[model samples]
Target: MKNTTTPPKIVALALLVFVGAVMLGYGVSRMSAQEPQGNPVTGGLLYDKWWTVTGADAPVGDHPLWATQSTNTRTGADTWRCKECHGWDYKGADGAYGSGSHFTGFPGILAIKGQPVADIVAALKGSTNPDHDFSAVLDGQALLDLAVFVSESLIDTAPLVNADKTATGDAARGQAFFAMCTACHGPQGNAIYFDSFEDPLVIGSLSSDNPWEFIHKARYGQPTFLAMPALYTLGLADSDVGDVLAYAQSLPGEPALSGGGLLYDKWWTVTGADAPTENHPLWATQSTNTRTGADTWRCKECHGWDYKGADGAYGSGSHFTGFPGILDATSKSSEELLAWLNGEANPDHDFSVVVDEMALDALVAFIQQEMFDISMYVNEDGTVAGDADAGRSLYAGTCARCHGADGKIYNFGSEDKPEYVGTLAVDNPWEVFHKVAVGQPGAPMPGALALGWTPQQIADVVAFAQTLPVE
Candidate 1:
């Protein structure tokens, strides 16, 4: 060991060199990994694009989401870049400029790089920006690439988003779209539900009911499974997106008038002045009570088109409600009838709230202008002039659903009064002729006019109604 051996010195020197090389290689790899993978080539080109509006350049500062940001400040192509609000890393004011005056608390799209192209496109097309959507600035492919980068490379936000759509999305644009929907669907979109069995789904119901589906559909289009039309097809501006969602979030989510009418047995309770009346004669005898159910809610229950109750059609079967027909009311003035509805002539039958002034006017209009005489066709013996056989064919095709073949399923009479179609046949024939010609109010009953029935065809129907049970 004491002998002079230079090998030890040489070995130590080689080891040092190897260690230094290894450290250098590791450092280079770390630096490379930290570099951003964003495609500036594609992103840069999309950044400066501009879309022309038909009208004067939208008022300078009127960006959809960023109300204060002026498009006029940016020259030529710079007016429409995503990087203006968001950073080069797609971090949006969350990265290098997060603390600057430009900071808008907006989230970065860098994390979404790996996401599906469709999602990215939707976000750009005002699907994501509640306040500031750039959809108008970018086309389909540009949006697709932007989304790809955000989904795959952006920082994970799973911890940030709550179960509801309140977090991680723009609420303003959502509100805007909701307003557009309110036109046909009512303010709440509950007027008509494509699905009847389930809870009536409105815009609020759809959003709160299923937030994921809401987000997915709101961004893209609604799933093919539903009847909802795609907002993209409507060419809505990007900025309007958040406005709609916000409005929808504020609306009532529960089903409207769900079971309110059943408890009162009054369609008038829900429909207000639009409720039907007991103008038909045979309305009393077909049901259990004259004041309830589908029958009492209808105007045709008491007065026949002939305005003759049991005297014409309700003289016999199930429709034999003994309420007096409206044949006599034809001579009554509009004021007199309005007073009657308000409980003047019939205090117990006050329908003031259910039948408002406008509705009363409609009823009076029907009575005064529309009522007619049918004595020539309808005999006291319940026989008609035209043809009963022909009438039967027409009834089966058109009038059978609600009226039934016998024309007597609902009764309109109270215990104190007993009236039916048979009673109308013998009493008043004019009211019967009127209803058959014009159709009953508030009921799905078809109008003879729309059905293209001839005067002779109507005469035949009256003949058959005369033969129906009225007792």
Candidate 2:
């Protein structure tokens, strides 16, 4: 009837209107069927460490796809990490992990950045490779988040990190930004030991060694350590990230001798080991000190807080012991020290019974590297051999930030028996010198050594500290 009665122009107009209506209806239906976008930031963190992000225990056994690659020899939870398979640069086989220890020979997802989210999700569900299916470990929402990340958040990291693991950025600007990290990582980034106490690799070393990985973690925050502030979420620009990396790289990369110092103070406390129920095997040799149990096991109890044993602070007081000091052990080789620790020498002097090999190694390092003879700096009368006037300036500039202008900020002892920084410096200059040089363990205290200060400078700081109120 329309073909018989209607003109050609009207017929054409009706046809166009009908087609347009059908197209509009189809578009609306498609939009209604689509799911809401998932959180990409969550997705980025999940990519770094899925279990930590989801609060799930890391899956046991190697990922099914792990068997396909043999270059990366990491086992357990490490192999399950997405970054292990796909490179931090996101170029995978074509990028940093293409060879060397982390080589996986897997293609990266950078090429599929703009691909459909549904297609990416399907691939993750093993539509492409059955062995690559993550559905068993991740829920539907997690997969969607990951899909959104792949579709939206991934960036080309090639231009960000250099071949030598350095980044182009301003160190001074980075230093200011790094103040936020000081509480946990210390001024030189040596506060947290990433590996065993023996290895002593900290954040500074990690940043210098692998800037790309550092950048990734800095942007997404560390997994399991939820408190780590993500620069990305903080709205830091990419250039600022480079600046932070630059400052981190500039930090001291030496082993954390402070860990050894802490271990020496209380091995069980630092290592999280139970205190030995019995006295140390060498405890019976000492008769003067009435201390028992955990106190007897402390290296400082035997070696003396000044590390001179009978010759120093603990020589004849209530803390006294006839036990020899370890300051002499500094001259001995690491092998000889290790033998003494493992009982190859005198079995009674062996520390292996209570501590691990790494802890023992840390002790050896402390003896070798940190046990400097402070007799030149600290006199028998407990006075320092340094320029107190010069120290006043240094102390006012540095230590005053934490200890206060008058150095009476923190009362180390109780309110009834208050002890400030001055008390420690006056009572035990040796201890102050050691703490000043190596920094305090398990605290954010900066080390004079890390600050590029000389032995004389440290002595000066200790001298100035002695002048503060001791309550």
Question: For model 2, what is the error of residue 250's alpha carbon versus the real structure, in angstroms, after optimal superposition?
Answer: 2.3
Q: What residue pairs clash in candidate 2, if any at all?
A: none
TM-score of each: 0.31, 0.59
The list of candidate 2 runs beyond 4 A from truth reads 1-37, 114-118, 256-258, 265-279, 285-296, 300-347, 350-471
Listing every candidate in turn, what is its Cα RMSD in Å to the true structure after a full C-alpha superposition? Answer: 27.7, 18.0
Per-model tally of clashing residue pairs = 98, 0
Q: Across residues 222-319, which tens digit of lDDT does each residue of candidate 2 receive?
A: 76665455666555678888888889999888654546777887777666677788888788887888888888888778887678888887777798
lDDT value, residue 409 of candidate 2: 79
The CA root-mean-square deviation of candidate 2, after full C-alpha superposition on the true structure, stands at 18.0
Overall local distance difference test of candidate 2 = 0.76
